[model samples]
Structures are given as structure tokens and as C-alpha cells.
Target: MSKRILILTTIISLVFGLAFSGIIFAADDSYWQDHKEVLDELQSDGKPPTVIPVELIPQEDEATTALRERLNEIIDEYAPRIIEMSDWLYHNPESGYYEYNSSKMLGGELEKQGFEVTYGVEGLDEGYNSVIEERFDAAGLPTAVIAKYKGKTEHPVICFVFEADALRAPTREKGAFHGCQHNMQGPTAVGAAVSFAKLLEEKNIPGSVWAVLTPAEEIPPPDKSAMAKAGVFDGVDIAFFSHGFGPTSKRNEAGLGNCCYLIDAALYDFHGKTAHGSRAWKGADSLDAARLFLTAIDMLREHSEPEFRMMSAITKTGNAPNVVDDYVQIDHWNRNTDPAGQAALQHKAEQIDQIARGVAMAAFNEVDIRHYAYYYNGIEYGWLNALMWEYVHEYGDPEAISEELGKPSGWAECGYPSVNFPGIHVKPAIAGTPEVAGHSDENADLTISEKGHRALVQTAKIEGAMALRLVLDPKLLATVKEEQARWQEYGLEKGLITEDMIRK
Candidate 1:
């Protein structure tokens, strides 16, 4: 074995041996005990078995290996701060487009780490600005935070995207809650970015690190998509995102493919003249139009492809039963797996718009439809996915480790940016954690638990290692860029992306 591989083996053996003996960092003892086969396999080969095809994996040189070690050390050094930040976000939850304090806290931490922090995106289109003003009573996205740390060179800029918005909790006493565990994302990305930045400064590496804190993930009008359109991701070469703990205890895998469905969202407003309850026939009822619109949309389900989905919510209705309703507003979301299904999604959206209009006309109400958001499905890289999977298996909770490799699952955030550049979302399993569904108080509580702390550190280590590899290996970076370009072409050919999505 080479010296680097030998060193890696020794280190793995030492860490596992300590855990086995009930010495240090033994949060999941039963898991370590059950995974002795994995340890034996690593000890015999000095390298972890390939999760992806061996050819697709990048080989690390001595220099790159050393830099990776330093990166992990930096992440370790910042683990306390990382956990603290996550906990703070958990306690102080804020909803989308209103995460002012969350932004300040996360951005403040980055600023303390010597990053140049900027708040909010400039030059957003009038429509987006109007939405912001109408929704949150803010002029622009006041909570959007962008922090940059440039090294000796600007090429190969690495970006980290973070979400800090909490889900609205109408039932609970708190108006907003970190049920989705977005509280973990900002700290995780910040931890990784700050560590990578430190490595670049110390090693005098030529690159740039950007940590973009986007708000309103759980709500409509996806912030990353808006940010992408506003040129926030213009110069970013590659990006990385991290989320809360996984739902499975088995090893999670990553591969080439899209992660989520494409979502097209719109708001429909039905307007009519109000009339007294005793003489309701004297005026048209907007509520009737809204109900008809919803029923018509439901009728489309049978005609839609099995993968297509629609969700609608009535945000406004009649104020009193005694008076005819003058106005009704419905927010609708249409979704489908993309590239192959983009046309179907577009058709369905148009049909839904037509249904709204038809329903309004039948009810003698005027309907206004506003297209608010479109979340495209983004691409993933097998090489990066494999790299992150390897780190996840290495440092992740053994109980959560799955022996099976995952298929290509595309990223959801910054789908537009994913087409423009290469990116991956790192989702390492929290150690000794049980299966927990997202957008729950249980998941949010786990963000501050022992498993959550361990996962935070592991995620940062994985992200820093991946970023270091990209920084140290120019050939790998080039290969990634080429792969992205090919995927972009495939997207255009497959009707997954339009010519307009291609950045100049």
C-alpha cells in the first residue's frame, strides 16, 4: 500500500479500536460492534470499498490527502460553534422571507470568520420584489445573506447554499418552528465553508468560498431559484448543500440523477361584487368560483400522469356568512419529475390556469392568476456523490450505514444553478439516531441532540473533504465541469431545461 493509504488505514483502525474498547466518541457502541465486518474489510485493504464504480472515483494524492486531514482538523476545531449556531436557530425559529434574526446570526458568524458578508440580493425583478412586499411587508429579501472569502484566485469558486426558514406552526404556541431542521443547514454549511476557507488561507490555495443563506425554503416562491435568476450564483463553479438527519438508519448512498420533482406554483384570485345574505343572488360569489376551480383541478388528476401532483390552499375567503364573498385567493402547486416530465408539468399548469378562468367566468367572477415559482430538478455528479458517500460511511453513524449504494438522486435547491455548474447535497446520517420524518418537532429536537452534534461534525468533515479534493485536483474539477456541460446539453435535448436557463 502507498504511504497515504497506509496512514489512512492506521487512522481508521485506531479510531475504531478506541470506539470498540469503550474509550472515546462511543456514542453508538452497538453500531460499531455490529459493523466489525466493515472494519475488517478496511483494515485488509487500507481503503474503503468503492460505493460507486471504481473508475468513477477520484484518486487522492499525498498532497491532497494531507490537505484533507487539515480540513478535518479545522472542522473539528469549529464543532462547538457549529452546534451552538444550530441550537440557537432551533430556539429562535423564523418563517420564510422573515428570517431576519436567523440571517443576522448565521451571517455574523461568517463575518467573524473573516468573510465579507453581504445582505440581500440586489436588482431583483419587480414581480419578485412585489411578492416580497406583499407577503412579508418587506421591500426586498432582507434576510438573504451572502458571505464570500476569496483566496489567491477566483476561478473554481466553491459555493455553499443554506436554508434558515422555519415552517409555520399554526397549531403550536410558537408561530414558527424549525420542524424541518433547517436550523441544522445554516450551521452545517457555515461550518464547512469556514473550515474550507481556513484551509485555503493556510495552504495558500487558489479558490473562493461563498456561503449563501437563503430564506423561505418550506414556503412557496423557492428562494434559491429566485436567487439564481438574480445572478447570485453567476460566478460559482460548484456548490454544496446539507440538510437535517436522514430518515433511515442504513447507510445512505448518492449517485447521478435529480433529487426532487419540478414544482410550478401560482396564486389565483377570484373577484366578485359583494351582496347581502338576504339577496345573495344580486351579486356573484367569488367563493363559488374558488370552489369550482378546486374541483376542476381535482378532476384533472385522473388525466395527469401518475407522477404528477397538485396541492392547493385557500388563503382567503368570505369574511362573514351573512354577506356574499367578494374575493377568494387560492395558492396552487403542480409538481412532476422533470426533464422527461417538464412538458407534462407545463401542460398541467396551463390547464389549471384555464380551469381557474373557466370557473371564474361561470361564476361571473374575474380571476387573476400569478405564476410565482418554478423549482426545476437539478443534476448530480456520480463522482462527487461517491466521494461524499465514502466520507459518510467512514464518519457517519454505523447504525445508519446502508451497505447498498444509492441511485442518482438529483438536488432540489438551486436547481437552476445546478444546471449552470456542478453541485452536491451532503446528507450524512446522524450517529445513533432513529428514523425521523422531516418537518416535525422530533426532527428539530434532534438537531441539538448527541446524534445531531455528531452528524454536524461528520457533515462538515465530509463537505470540507469534498471541497478540498476539488480544490487540490484540477483534473477532477475539469471533469466535473465537462460532465455538467454534457448534462446541460442532455437537459436541453430532453426538454428538461430551456435555452433561457443556459447562463451566458
Candidate 2:
């Protein structure tokens, strides 16, 4: 009986030891290799892998471990450089559709890194796309440049756009500073792209990375829709972009909005008679026509949604105030909560424009309205947002990003509806601050704080990681294709929209 008991004990101990050994094995390459199929299936479900991550594998990849260790090192090493770029941009602020120096410098940085640059792509029939500035020394207009790094495979083309074109600088000289922290985003994007290329060159990453420096995200015009029209993203397997926030929170809210306004802009020219001083009666008042047009638009606003936004900048006014101005140019933009609402607003704006033309005719001779740009809002990529949420939580403080801003931080989600979209579920914003971690303040302070550089570094690593995964992780890549296909179908089912609709 004692021998039988001892034998049973030995058997139980051996079984327990074997189970532990299996777990250990799972932590190595075997774990990922073995569970690859399971993970592929789970991709459709859109959940994180239930299987445990492989252990010791990270240590095995010396390059990956080095990258993870000094991931922030690059951002830190280059953060000051990013700050220099941002500070320069902040001091020399520019408005939408006219950012010359900013674009040049931002794109030029990539050139220094041996990236094949494309300054002006055809199809954009506009002046230029300076989302944050109107300062122009650029070679061409309506330009969206790309820094290309060709790799082993064309199938895994990952594109990243720095929508850092903005007029911000929350605490600095306020007109058009890096207030939106776009300055940070653009340079950081460049750094990330550069780093990605470096990795491929040094190591053996199979995919390619295209660092796209896009303009006109901050101040999207209602009529101009270059991004949507360019079809630059047609062949992209994965895309990564980033935005700024106050330093109060660390994590980005895993929020999703099914719909969003792209960009639309319209300019109407009211032509009248320009008379000499004291010859007011001789000249019909075009200013009155412009005023009438303005009034008509104001009236239309009352019928629009509370969440909707309407703004106008007098792009071109008369050369002189005393002269009975012969021409008055009005530039207007609209941002609606959803596609239907945006279309409705645009229809209403057109009606108002006609009324304005009639009023201009009453006050002047002729009225001309030109569709400056058309932006059609489209679907946000669920996979991308899901990926972002996964990354944001892993790296960021949940409390920081999960909160909402009150009063006047000026983040209106009505148009950029990704906030409430169902694809990437999000928690409500619980709190906000003007301190570190908040969107505006934190962005402003990132230059001086380690936290800020960390944020930038983390974003870069995740982007690079995703880029790496696109080629290395075949199972993950299939899931991405599934999501992208679904999104494309959904965008199609909804009426096709142009940049004009995108603005509102």
C-alpha cells in the first residue's frame, strides 16, 4: 500500500511538472506559432488574442529588444529637433491652404533621410494645402507630398500621414501656433518614418513605409477634397496618424464615430462698381451684397444642428475700405455631425448662396460663386482605431484620455465623429485639466517634459510595430484586409462623397 501511494504521488508530481513546462514552452516562439491559427480566427471577432504572449521571444530578437529599450531614445534624441521645428512653425504661423515654409521644411527633413520625395502630385487644382498657415514660398499649390522608402514587398505598403498642419500654440503667440500640437505630430511622424526606414535598412523587415506629409486637416475647406480625390490611400494596407491633446491624460480614448465631415469650401465673388471717393452714388455697393450674403448664411445657421459648425473667413476683401469695392470674396466652411446632416447643410448653403446672389444683384451687377473645394466625409478605419485603442491603453494613462473637456478647450467632436463611433468603443471623458496630460496644455508643455517625449516615442514604436506586423504577422495582416474590405464596402453603400461634402 505504501509503495502504491508513493507511485501515485510520483505520477501526480510528474504531471504537474509537465504542465508547467508546457506553459514555459508557450512563452517562446512556439506560443505564437502554435496559436497563429487561433489568433487568425479571433481577428474576425475583433478581440485581443486570448492566448498568452510568447515569453523570452522578445529577448531573443536583439533588434526588437533594443528598439523597445531605446524606442523613446529616438524620440528623445530627436525630440529637441522636433521642438526646433515646432517652435519655428509656431512662431511663424500660417493659415489654411497656404502653408509654404512649414510644408517645405517638414518634407525637406525626409529628403535629408534619403526618402524619395514627391512635392506636387497632379489632380489638385487649388493654390496650396496649408492647413495651418497661409505663408507660401512653396514650389506649387494643392500639394501633398510623400517620402517613399521602397521595400521587399509591394503588398505590405503602410502609409502614414502627418496631419500636423494646424494653427495653434495654446500659450505662445496665439494666432496660429502649434496650439493643436500639429507641429509635434508632423515632425514626430517624420522621425517615426525615418526610424522605420532605418530599421528596414539595418534589419530585415520585409514591408515598405510611405511617410505622407498631408496638408489641410486642421482647417478643411468645404469645396476642396484633395485627400479623398488623390486616391493616394488606394493601395495602402495600413495607415497611421496621430493628434495632440492636453497632458492631463496619458491614454487616447478608444472612441469611434461611424461618420465624419471631410472638407468642403466655397468662395463667392460679389462684383459691383468701384467708384472714386465721394462717388459712392456712382458705384453700386458690393460690400452690401457681401453683407447680404453673410446675412443669408447667418439665417441658414438657425435651421442647422446645434452640433454643427459654420465659419467664414473673408479671404479677399477690397484693396481699400473707402472705395466702393467692386469685389468682395467670402470663404465659408461647414462641419455637420453626420453625412446626411452635412449634405442637408450644404444644400441649405447653396440655397442661401443663391439668395445671396439675388441680393448681390440687387446691390451690385454680378455675383459669382466658385466651388473652391469639395470634401466628402467617409468611414474611419475600425481596425486602425481598434489598434490605436489597444496601443493607447497599453501606453497611456486611462484616466487622462478617458475624460472630456468642458467650457472652451475648443475640441468639437460633432464633425470628427470618430469620438462616438461604434467600431472603436470608447469610455466617457471623466475629467480634464490644463496641466500635464491634457490635450492643449500637455501638447504645449511636451517640449520640456519627459512625459511628452515618451508619448511621441511610444506613438512611433507602435506605428513601427504595426508596420512590422503587417509583413511579419500574416494572420494579423489577413484581419486587416478583412476590416479594410468591410470599411470600403460600407463607404460604398453610403452615397459617394467628394471633398466638398467632406468639409461639412
Candidate 3:
């Protein structure tokens, strides 16, 4: 009987140990098992897929032919200036928020082209304007530029967003370069705006063109969504935007199928009385409280949602080894895809604070917690995506361009930019292979290559055509506006349109 009891106790202990060690066994019956042979045949052949160029001929109508001819002529006329702008931006890169020269330069060029200019329109801190006037002679806020060309009254407002921030990665001369291809943004947007403005003037097209130079898209202290809520896009009818994605040209057809994860970060500080290491029992140990707090957080992963992610770094942990640590600071962050998931993660974070407090109380210490950053995911517009694709095929030769650029495919794919507006994010190919993945020095260099220049010209043409098309067809604008209304209603239900996201 005793032996049987011992055996049961051992089994229970083993089970508990495995659970604590994050070892779990689950049954697997995947559908892939039965289709391995067929799936294997579809595996990669170590080469990019061939892209067949789909050159769409405009509809055989006088209006369509005229629009196409005008688009072509505008591209031919502005090609040199556009390429020069891109080259200049490539040589001179600037980081986010501090894009003073970039903004001034781009804004000056827009003003030269007869667009009404507005400068220094971005400030984010609470009471920043009021406080700065009292403390300092001037308010030093980040700079952004807005250029407008009013064609005719009562027409659709087509806005183009130009991001003028470079990446601060390791490769550049001073760890600040246009690695994210933001250098391409200015040329393409300016080219499109200039062409569209000319078309409207020459043909009396009834529409307005507004080109916006937003500061710090790469790392936004004030991101695009914040800019929108701050009235940057107040009277904008629709926005035209694009990004670089490798050497292939793609469009977000289904809008942002999967949006960027919402992230929030906070700092927690724990305080205790210091004492000698030998006489540690006489004083409270803040490090002890921090340890238990982090342990609880690690244990939380087992029960948290699958999409949740959390990480922490111990920035401060006392002064000397001989004395008991009195103060400790922890910086932690959490991320999730949706609002509910983000809320859940936030709750967990709060619970961690409580845990810290509880542990501190037991150790006769105290803790202070403060949250610093919270980034919400932007909303997507699907209806606008379809319209953008029409313009892409109308103006682009995906296959021929892909072959010449040595890209894998000419087909346009989808993407999600964290901005709350109805705009199409197109990725036109630059020259050469993607040496580095995502945002790297290699990608930055490609932005200045000859192929990159061609990409700038083509993208401008595509955007120019799209902007013109929207003005010509008011029905499309009405449909998009309807879709946007429905989306806003849905977003309200999902907690996307919170009080903080709206302007007073």
C-alpha cells in the first residue's frame, strides 16, 4: 500500500514539473498529411516566378484615348525633373521628426510649381504650444509641409502623402539614410502632383491636388494616424500613397488583410530601503520584488492569448553588490493584432504591476508605474483598393518592368500601412535584387539606382493617372465614400474611434 502511494505521488510530481517547464502534448491530425505529394510538387524551385506583363489598352473611346495621351505626355515632360528630385533625396537623407531640410526643400519645390504652401503644422505634446510660448520665445515642433493647387471649385480633393524621413540603421554614414525608400516618396508624389496640376490647368479638369510632406513615417513620435486625427487630412477627399516592396510591383487589393499589431510600452519603478548584504534581513530588497514580478509575467504566457506578445528589459537594478538594491526600473511592452487582444494584454500588464505591488508589500517596499506609449492599428479601406488596381494596370507594364528589373514577378500584391485613411499603398520595383530584407542599407542603395529612378517615373505616372481618374469619375468617389462611412461605423463598434483619436 505504501509503495502504491509513492508511485502515485511521483506521477503527480512529474505532471506538475512538465507543465511548469512549458511542455505540453497535443493530438495532431493535419490535412497536409494526406496531401504531401501534391504539396511537395508546389514547393519553390529556388527561383522567382516569371511575371507576364499585362499591358492593358485603354478603352476605345475618345475620352479614354485623350486621357492616356495626356498622361503619357505629362510623364515625358516631367521625367527628368522627377529623376533629379529622387537623386537629390538619395544623396541627402534625414531622420524622422528632424526632417527640417527635407521638409523645407520639398515645400520650396512645391511652392515653385505654383502650389499654395503651409509650413510647420505638426505639434504633439499636450499644451505644447501654450507651454513653449511661456517658457521659450518660440515653439519648436516637428515640421511638415502641405502644398495645395486648387483647380476648380466643387470637385473631388485628391491628396498625396509624401514621407520624408530616412532610416537610422547601422549602414549609413551617420546611421541615418533613406533605407526605407522614403527618398522615392518625394519624387513620385511631386511628379504626380505637378502632372495632375498641369492636366487640370490645360484641360480644365475639375479637381484639386494637395501634396502633403509628413515628417517621420519611419518612426513616428506622431504617426500618420495621429497626423490624421490632428486634422492633417481634414478636408481631404481621398489620399494616394505608395511604398517600396523589393523589386516587384504590388497593390493592396483586399486592403490590409492583416493589420500591424497594436503596441504599448510602459516603465515601472520599484523602491526599497538599502542595507548591507550581510544584514539584508534588516532592509527591504527591491530586486526581490522585481524578480517575482517578472516571474509572474513569464508564467502569464501559458494562459495568455495566442496572438499576444510581451517583452521586458531591466534598465535599473541598484548600485552596489555589497548593499541591498533599493531601486529598480523595468521597461516592458505588449503587442496584439486587434483591440480586444490589446486590451487583454494591457490587463495582463496591469496585473503585472499589481503583482509587483504585492511582492513589494511583502518585502516592505513600494512600486510606481507609468505607461508612456500606445500605438493603435490604422483602419483599412477595401473599396479604394479596387479603384487603385484599375489605375495600376492602366498605366503600368508589370511584366516588362519586372523582367527588366529582374524581379520575381510582375503581379501586384497587397500590404497594410498603419494609417487611418482610404489610400492605396503600391510597391513598385527598384533596380537589382533585394540584397537585404526589409529596411536595410542595400535596400537604401537600390532607392538611388538607375532602376529606382525608372520606378519613380512609373509610380508617378500611375499615381497621376489614378488622381485624374478619380476626378473624372465622381461615381467612384461616391462609392468609396459610402464604403468609408460603413467602415467608420464598424470601427466605432470595435473601439477604434475612441475619444483620444478624435480632435477636440
Model number with the top lDDT: 1
As a whole number from 0 to 100, the lDDT of residue 393 in candidate 2 is 52
Clashes of each: 11, 63, 3
The residue ranges of model 1 lying beyond 4 angstroms of the native Cα positions read 1-58, 247-260, 275-284, 321-323, 337-339, 397-399, 429-431
Worst lDDT 10-window in candidate 2:
405-414
| TM-score of decoy 1 | 0.82
TM-score per candidate, chains pooled? 0.82, 0.67, 0.70
Best by TM-score: 1
Instruction: Report the C-alpha lDDT of model 1 over 1-504, residue by residue, as the tens digit.
Output: 245433433443344334222233322222222343653463322322223343345466788888888888888889999999999999999888889999999999999999999998887767766766777776568899999998877756889888999999967776898888899899999999999999889988878999998778887677777777789987776788888777442322332234566788888989998999999999899999988988898899999888988999998887799999999999899988644676687889999999998999999999988888877656666556666766776677666776665544454553666766578878786546766777777888888888888878888888888888776655455445544544555556667677776667
lDDT per residue as tens, model 3, 35-130: 334433532341111211122212335795588578779877988988888778778887776777888888888999999999855554444333
lDDT of each: 0.75, 0.52, 0.61
lDDT of 1: 0.75
Which is the better candidate, 1 or 2, if ranked by lDDT? 1
CA shift at 351, candidate 1, in angstroms?
A: 1.0
